[model samples]
Target: MKAVLFKVGLVLCVLLSACSNSVDDSIDPETADDDLEGPISRPTSGYGVDGVYKVAELSFPNTEYPGTQVTIFYPQGTTSGRPTIFYAHPYGGEDKEYNRGLFEFIAKKGYVVVFVPYPTTDISIDHRYLTLWTGFTKAATDYPNIIDTKKVGFMGHSFGGGASIGLAYKAFTEKGWGQDGRLLFTMAPWYSYQISPAQLLNFPSNTKMVVQVYDEDKFNDHRLAIDIFKNIGIANAEKDFYYLKSSTVANYRYGTDHNLPNSRSAYDAYDYYGVYRILDALMDYSFNGNEAGKNIALGNGSTAQVTMPGYKNELMAPLEVTDNPSPKYTQSKYLFPCSSQENPRIANCN
Candidate 1:
């Protein structure tokens, strides 16, 4: 009887082991593959490609704005019909070398990047806006064969951020340039002029705007980004407000400050990993028409959703025509020299 009991126990153990194997084999192949693959990497807190294409830098005298210079970053071996981006430098930052990392990264991504340096002496807000618009127009005209004018995008930091908005307004209302689709990305945008809520509504419906805010920014707080985002009237357009959270990464000590967007001042965790990821995804989605990029921008999944632990985001859903009416403006005003009286250099007045 003892021998029979031992044999029965051994058989039961074997059957149990076989049942476990059968259950493992029954898993769906696709589900098993996904389990092995793991979650998609998020761009919110990581760096992107490091110079995929060789870059060629060229400088040209701006005929539109005398004494001003326009620098072009052309990717070598790039064929004709590439997307273009107009980058406006922040006030007191006329030297492109200060932000070389950002510019080169964008160029390596296959977009023709034009950097416009305005006169640091002249603190005229309107003049800066005009210079940016003129520089972009000139770049597009000069490199018509290389730049796809229809796929133009604008980017800027600080005062240049305000100028980007102004340029977008001109491009949409007066110039009718970015009707096909335009991208406007502003980093820590300063309030140069008193932009009314109605004026903000004038942005083109097809325009995609991304406003970035540094959480620890003392000079220009996140409120400025919120205000700008609130006033945007493009109900049918894609818009997002991103807040770069302060980093606690080991040895990465720089908080998300006002100057964090500039390569000269940005920390590696924020610049390469954080800001670069956002810019890369934006360009991919807006210019390259990559669906993955759009998902990232919208915080759907992948890099977009995987930000730092403390980072937060807000998105503006596309508005329906029946729910949100089209924007109309009777008079377009160009406010001049909107710099603060205290500093006279910074564009922020309030």
Candidate 2:
């Protein structure tokens, strides 16, 4: 979880110079193969088809929120007006190396991504939200000409998933960022310190979201993802839920627990077919506006064939809304006694 902090003033200049730009600058998106029918196909297994864009990793200490650090993954020379994603790590997880493949995939797709790391000891969900906001604000300021701030996306896993919801809530209700377009993708979202279902209803109806759940998730359970999907008030057409089932037993270091999405080996069926493929499709649909990506995500026709063997998927076709369900809050074992008294700027801290 330890990151080497770099000087903020020199970050853009030094990091961009170090990065190698391999993307073809003249490829027009309107005529790109991504706009074709069926599922958007990948030319290779590991990397993306947008050619090579050098990956730049740099860390900067957040002055607004002390003890928080922002890590950026930028694809150098990806042309102007590229979409951006703000990523939040899971609780007690700090290393960007955990999801390096996924991050690289996103950057290679011509998007800027910023990962925010917060203190695990005196953690508060509001603090995590603020940390993400700081990261987004700083990234926008540093790469104004490169990033299209209007087309923003939020992604996270586990507790970070809950944090993504909180950040989106603020953007829609308070900050007005979602007025343009916003997309959210969360996996195995934990419910600790998340906003109420009513608060979620206030998000812009235009906001698109995808909730991913692991079938054998023991830590947070798949029901958490369902609950989040049910509470999201966006139009049924704008939201989708997926339940990912692993065909084979995971014998890796993290096993099948909640870490399946970030498993180190990309060759694994769950990581490659179940996790990465779905994520790539969602990003393509949301960021690139590819219809084929949407078809794949909705599990339409033979698109489910792209999933791993034995992977079961449920698409919210007739999207039913639940009536005023009682609030269910599952406290995290990592939760410690901390409040706004310690940090006045933390939202919703008691």
Candidate 3:
């Protein structure tokens, strides 16, 4: 047992050290300690303000798992049974300022937005999974009045985006979540572990999911996003894979990279139209049974879901979506897989 422990510890140290060298921690706006990065101009056309409830937010220090902090943003008037969103963050993305805009926006739209940052420095990615689950379970257990376990959504960006898949499986199977409604959204996600192929075949079939990949993200391979989009057990009708393209409106360009969801403070048209619009519709369709939301959120091939609003309500770049293995991101183009990522999880190399 001692010798086995030593090998695992040695491998984890090497993994963390190597990964720390590979990533630019500052690429995402984790620098902000407080407040949203200025004001975001909300689009008045799509995704109306269905939820104008004043939001109340609180942060909790985890005495049990000291490395993580869990914060909850919920409608101020809610007493219980509110739909919830469980958000996971990428590595080194512990600061709330990284996604404060999204959190506040979702909260104002009337959902319990839970943000939990997992440890990215010393622990194995598997332990990081535990940290995420610990924080999530802690929040749900402590605030049963706020989190409606039956109706919940799991979403994340980059590293968190990939992790959201494995975590959502845990949420659905163990907790019996999604009995009412569930949604999973991944934005330029990373390689996810802690979930076996068998588990991938068992995700809730009714779950609404969108695996979003950016056109300009040169870091994480798009194949990784394709992996989850293909493997997850959901049917074609229930899930969609989005290839978000970049757009230039006037002199300012909206680049769809790995960090579009993070926005680092200054949000653009994509944040409002490309993302938040569909997400709002997805939530409404899943949780509230709003049938109109299906066209915009999971709109099979509708013009509205595929097109994003650009300059002066003109045409922006449309999203490329496919449920099958896409030739655009083919096996020949498969660059970074488990073999090259050097993730200590060993599952990657498989």
Candidate 4:
């Protein structure tokens, strides 16, 4: 017993020494503070919904651009073949660091989020988006145990959002992928500004589509997304449309610019509400088989009702979500899921 104890003690001492040495080598002793905690940082706000967890980062290689990169926030502990979301960062955005807060929120909710970095200088050679799609495909193929290729959703903010629409159209129409699709929720995207009237009219409706617009957006026409939604709703195929009345209401903003990373503090509320709303729609549209897209209302004097594609006469109320019990922390108290129906517990990465 004495010999065993001594051996165990000796091994523990060696391990501790190794760890200490590693820390010494990696960190500058002069800069290191005795009070400094390690790599972990707590969230500034409370956890939102039940399935929502704090955000996390994921790194993968960019096949198109050898040294370039792509990142994702995956829900924790999700079993094999889970649904995935390809999230495109806003225009002129840097690494995943800028969107980490929002991505983390989505990731913790049992959905894998892929963030595409837009090359600021040259929009033509969007190798960043290519890399994102490629990396996502590779991850799904390589780790079928971790991803479900069948159920995939694409999303983006601003320019990223616009690009996501183009990408989705190409994927479904040109590439012949995701035939039996559900929905694409474009958060403050500019479909009307970027795509022409003909192009917008041409988009197919086999997949459900929802466009979120803030009334106060500065760039482009204010009601661009809603305008397109109306045209689509009136066009050939079946579609549903929803419009948010006030972007500045409870922890939400419509005036956010194309670059979210540079000014996260200025629009933290927008980040929270914008991301949560999109994710909520994607989750329901993809998994629940719910056709509640028509329930979104553009709050003004205009009288618009939520109606499914084929049966235009049948109107329904927008999705109703209830708030969860308050979180134990102070910062997170104001945070709430965009959809009251979202349960934060089940949404955790598990």
The model with the greatest lDDT is 3
lDDT of 2 by residue, 1-350 (tens): 11211221133223223322333753234422332111223344432243355555667887645765677776665547566778877655555666776676667656678787765433445665667677777777776666677777788887677678877777556656645567898877765344665777777776777777554455554445656676678766667676554333222221244565663433244454555566566666666677667655544323342433321332212221222222233323212111213222123321
Q: Is candidate 1 or candidate 2 better by lDDT?
A: 1
Off by over 4 Å in 2: 1-51, 64-68, 178-180, 192-194, 249-255, 263-267, 300-302, 309-350
Clashing residue pairs in candidate 2 (N, C-alpha, C atoms within 3 angstroms): none
How far off is model 2, as Cα RMSD?
10.0
lDDT of 3 at 330: 39
What digit string (tens of lDDT, one per residue) describes model 1 on residues 1-350?
23432453354234323320122221223311111111222232223545446677777787656876799887765557577778877656677877787887777666778888875445455666767777788777777666777777888876677667767676667666655567888887655353444667776777776777665554443444455666677543376666665544333354565566555543354565556766777777776667667655645334443443222332211211111222121112111112334222233223
Regions of model 4 farther than 4 Å from truth: 1-57, 123-132, 174-181, 190-204, 223-263, 267-270, 273-275, 290-350
Runs of candidate 1 exceeding 4 Å displacement? 1-47, 63-68, 192-196, 300-303, 309-350
Q: Which lDDT tens digits does candidate 4 get at residues 22-88?
A: 1212222232112212121222332223243334455677666556676756654444655667676
Residue 247's lDDT within candidate 3 is 68
Q: Pick the candidate with the highest TM-score.
A: 3
Q: Write the candidate numbers in order of decreasing TM-score.
A: 3, 1, 2, 4
Candidate 4 residue 16 Cα shift, in angstroms, is 41
> Which 10-residue window in model 2 sums to the lowest lDDT?
1-10
lDDT by residue (153-237, candidate 3, tens digit) is 9998766887888899999998898789999988877678778888988888789988788887654567677777877888888
Q: How high a TM-score does candidate 1 get?
A: 0.70
